[model samples]
Target: MRISRLRFPVLLAAVSASLTLHAEQTDLRVSPPGWWAGMASPKLQLMVHGPDIAGSTVSVNDSEFVIEQVNSLDSPNYLFIDIDIADISPGDYELTFTKQGKEIYKTIYTFRPRAANSAERQGFTQKDTIYLVTPDRFANGDESNDSVAGFVDKADRQAPGGRHGGDIQGMINHLDYIASTGFTQIWSMPLLENAMDDHSYHGYAITDYYRIDPRYGSNALYRQFSQQADEKGVGVIMDMVLNHIGSNHPWMKDKPAKDWIHHNGEFSATTHRRESLHDPHGVEADQKAFSDGWFVPSMPDLNQQNPYLTNYLIQNAIWWVEYANLSGIRVDTYSYSDKAFLSQWTARLTSEYPNLNIVGEEWTTNPVITAYWQEDSYRADGYDSSLPSVMDFPLQDTLVNALKDEETWGTGLVSLYNLLAGDFIYGDPYNLVIFGDNHDMSRIYTQLDESYALWDMAMTFLLTARGIPQIYYGTEILMANPDTDDHGVIRSDFPGGWKNDSIDAFAQQGLSPKQTKAYNRIKSLLSLRKEHPVVTQGKFTHFAPAEGIYVYFRTDEAGKGAMIILNKNEAENDVQLARFEPVLKEFSTASRWGNSNKISVKNASIEVAPKSASVWLLQ
Candidate 1:
């Protein structure tokens, strides 16, 4: 007879001491591993990390099940077991574990069906506009659960710059507001559990990937949010982080092995040399440093090279996708993980979802480096990737340059002109995700020095240009935080998030005339995008950038074409009729505002006002 310690508290019946003594005690828990919080598979992993849990039989809903792979995961106690389902069928299941034919522990497993592919689901395609919202800062529907037990941080709903009580239910309650804004999809930051004291508000450093943050809501509440989004004709994109975990995560205290984290003991910061990872002639030292470096000592980097760790991370992502019925996934710090592991992760996810979209955050301006990582690019050096979309950092940089750089040959708006000129470098230029600003960077309004016209022009081009578009939260209202550069300040609370607040952007109750105009302009622009597919799926053509007067066309064979004229000059410039003739053939008339009767276009010189952009429909 083998001997084992009976440490856990148990209330056993006095039926047979032999069976109780012979029974195996199984300790099972699953996480996305350190700092890695999202995966794409419709699976949950119960990594048995202590004793011989294999002898402990597993069952789903009291039905017998199979446990594969008795492998160790770098950590001595870890025994990886996968929990999978056929198709994304929604239901509740009872997961029970029995050792020596005696039931010991059981838990509930709830799976939600993935959303059916529709035009709403197509919001992830290269054609739709995405509005990124941080629910905690966006709006607050409940002020009751702001403070919870085990979470050290206190609620400061009054602190404008501090964390307010914005839960998943709050977002769910305002689906109409989001849907009405003409945004087809909402990508919220991580809603996973983060019980850490100081930085729990951001939700990046996740403590539990499977469980929803209590302050945010329960796992069931998240599913309700997803369902609500679908009902409102909007898709949901989960914001995931695969780079690191919080210092207070349970795994940090009871790590399965010593090598589960990179440089756990001899911790050193990474060089953040993103280019070096894809460098053809790069040295091993450079590669290791980039991949192994900790994002911050507080956030521990995961060891993805370990087989168990890799499987755990990948499966966690899938579970959420299927569990929440997510339409797309937006990965945080796309270049921070092991490149080989990322390739495998993307391939598996796309293979499973097929039409599902995954956008990575590779914030680099060099198109070659960004393009090389995209799916189906034939790399000269033989590095393979299956990533579907990448954040268009080059175009974003060029756009900023267009607004700030003085008009010069091969510079300024010409930089933007030249950037689009190289669309041939991309496999599907339309697949790239374009954005002005995100949660990490400074707000776009601050970057443009509070120029409303410049911000509007950038928004127009991003929406009309050939690619998927993502707008940062509060951008529609021209929120700004300059010089300070504090991300918290930039991600300030929404005007009416608190129960007792004055300004209400959600209802448009309190607003200056200019602010209301900005809000209405964005709402109308997004509505236009939803109403017209010519802007989303039409072919893109551009004229040479001349003295800050940049023009582009989105035309299709159905005689539907929209010409966008952006005038950045201080003085209004007379646009030559010749500049419009090449693309506006046969259609000798145009509608300046896309609504009025078509106007004759015979040798007519149009004057484009300074600091404004106009979209005219050609007929």
Candidate 2:
């Protein structure tokens, strides 16, 4: 086992204080295990754990490395050593531990080299379409690691919430299929170790922050997968949980500090009142309950107010970005953590990797609440979370409502126009992650009540509208959870993921007519975004919904652009071009985006099919 994992005998077991120990027979554990020599910050804090290790003196023989301080928490078994690694050579360095004037232990620590231009790596932008996947339900490529020992959540294909044996290898095997679908980025659910007995497949309730779950694959395999993904033109984004962790985590039994967890590690449910953070009429107790309460009985909310714990989390995130070569991060439960710590966390991360993007999950349909968590552009309170982006929950809800509601003066497509009219509240609307549906909600096809036409219309708007687009796995073939909104069913196993599966979505075998059409529609539109390029960066201009016909134009600086027309009318509608003449007059020729047919844009009125979308490239 690598020293980075901090592998050692269980720290919960009692041990004799006077027992003699050496490198070969010691219970000591150190993290991160290794660090890069060159970083924006030179200080590295090593959390050392063992029996009676708190009072030991740490020393190094090298002059380049300096031990800043040794801090002993309330626990007698842990030591936090702060060291300066500025300009240190990339190699192994030995450190000795002495106690009571006697040499007790010695170990070698390593410093690694940063990959070329790692600090300048670019993050996902509007040009990239993100594919979200539920890892354990995505595929099962490694049968050997199906039910790893000590992890009670064994693979049970019949159980909706049970582990289905998907691993990093499964994703690695299907990179070509994903890339061919016109996706430029992949955002998988939490890939960290969730050691719970059941439902550990989601990867959200992390047990060990540094170790990847053995069931999924080793840490080495994950890093290799990310590097390989880059070769296929697909970037990787890690889903991180900063609010809480599994109750079974080792820290629950052997805490480094008394206040490491909120409410003394007991269960106190959070009100989930994110608006309380900035609510004008909220009480202090309600705000405290929302920020400091546990998410659930099995998930212990972390106390980021503790400075030591805060440093540990900040360092852990930086370690993963460096180790896995990540393109971005999606923070789960963004507003649940301490406000002050979140600001510090994001500032440090962005400072270290200036070009990296970090999007937080603030699930609120209120644009005002979501905008408060982003950078200062849309905020007036002078409080900055330093977050680069946030999920567009308002727009997602609006889109779904717009598609399903009956067309009326205030309902249906008009709701979409009204919601987006308030986009000015968002600091950078283009940076928000817009999606039809995610793992937490019913599938987009299901949300549209299984209407193939409505689903395709939603896909067209999602792909060509403002902001970056993210599609859930299996949505290409129009996967849906019709009977229920159970997350397990929503994140059901993908077809052809297992070898003996009856169907193969990847191979395009045994698909219904609607499924096939939906698949083709998504691929065609996504490819248009890549081919046209203007849609990703063009200025958005839209006409309010009128008579069930809505039109929007994506115009670039060169006056070249694309036009998206969505029609909800049950009968064919003639969309008058007079209102769009200002933008459409410049272009006399137009071609269907997903098809090869060329049409004239100078027509006074364009005939649009009933409940269909018309996308055209203008020239």
Candidate 3:
């Protein structure tokens, strides 16, 4: 059970009276710089940090808001104040710290009113095509921030794992390129501060939750980027890491409690066996080893069971969503954190913004394991995850393997068919986020062994298939990491993102015929998808794979429909139109998508290009 806030004031009052005799003037800091009033959750925990500040008698100058409790942890430098801001209006209020009845220090905190209908802002949905980017490698619009004064890692384009100087300004500069590419949402890798000595370009090892990486840009710049992206009809999905923090995080040096981190100040790597969470016969030791272990020696796993720490993390997530006006969030390691804490965290955020969408990374290829974390899932343990969405790793793996393997028995496309048939395991199949490849995985072009035909098939399935689709940066131009799966090479610099690059993908200059075709194909499909609501909000029907061909259809309530056919043969195959008579009964003509040519249904057969995926509109 969690400790009660009612007992905190009495305990802290005694400590404050004793420390007042030796109190001295000092600096004070509060996290979540400020908050807004009238939030769904009336409670707000302010983490006050300063030298010997925990024992100070804390009080708010305003009478509208009540200071429910003041908590002092094992560390003398931190104080947790729980305040009820339910009935308070938006305004400035002074937080005064008195020691022995003498005023020691005072600081002003602001509570801004929320934007009109801010809670009703829509989150990313199936209609959105998300483009994932690694900001450091995407572009460098601000050279000044490439190597900040205090940053440990500087710009080094030659080093694949080193910072390449991409900043928020670079993303802002290319908003038009993104919007024109048919991507409605941009899910950039973590842009939070990662003040590490090396390999910080990925932004996974977060050192500061509130501060944006100076090398990337300031916090205000990121907020501005989100606003500008919104103006261009694009939403921003922030990537966040909740499982661990960089070793250099301030908490590592000055921990508030002994159990703030797992392993009790010692390093014990996680078993990486994510299955332990749902394993029926799983032993207690294995579950503990998996969740309590550190991700790496450099990244410390946070212990979420600590109520103070839990509240801090929950507040931090809400702070970002409110401050940046984010459309969605992509949690880095979803199952690695404490399961109960995840429920609380997601529930609080959802309660605040009912329409917000959050997609968690489970990284498991098993449908059962991945689906277990979604909200309203059926499980033996009866765990109700409040998560709205999860990465479709199971479908992703099946899609890739099916496209690569030959059509033999229950192999190849049959595997994909079976996987889609298993969609019943998910509470909401459309809420799952589907992607061909991400920053962590090999590029789709490379995954398909650089075959343009296979690439086209994969993209067609991704865009037309149910659920939200996320395309990695440079996928439009067929970026490949053929040599190795090195993080640096996979997240390569965009051709036109920098100043001196001869090839500018944005301008469509100096691109090969194959690259141009791939780019145009994606653009056309995305444009069509944006115009067709049936693809985003329609009922799905699929025919089992046969003779190296797979067929599927998406139809809406109004009778509008789309048919997609995937042929894996090297020679053009004649598809008998009679087999699809059930769906094509009312239509007389079939026209290929992205083309004006129409063929009469009287022909009884349609010629499908070899080694290609095709979509047709029946009218």
Give lDDT per model, in order. 0.76, 0.88, 0.88
Backbone clash pairs for candidate 2 read none
lDDT of 2 by residue, 1-619 (tens): 1222232232112222333445433677788878887899888899987777888899987877688999998998888999988867776666777779887766667788889999999999989999999999998989999998898889897898989999999999999999998999999999899999899999889999999999999999999999999999999999999999998899999999999999998999999888888877779898899999987899999999999888899999999999999999999998999999999999999999998999999999988998888786556567877898999999999998998899999999999998888888777888989999999999999999999989988999999999999999999999999889898899999999998889899898988888888888988988889888898889888988899988998989897799899999999988877788888988887787756877776756778899999898999
Model 3, runs deviating above 4 Å:
1-27, 600-603
Tell me each candidate's TM-score: 0.88, 0.95, 0.95
Clashing pairs in 1: 35-244, 35-245, 39-317, 39-318, 40-317, 40-318, 41-318, 41-319
Looking at model 2, residue 436 earns an lDDT score of 96
lDDT score of model 2?
A: 0.88
Model 2, runs deviating above 4 Å: 1-26
Ranking by TM-score: 2, 3, 1
Is candidate 1 or 2 superior in TM-score?
A: 2
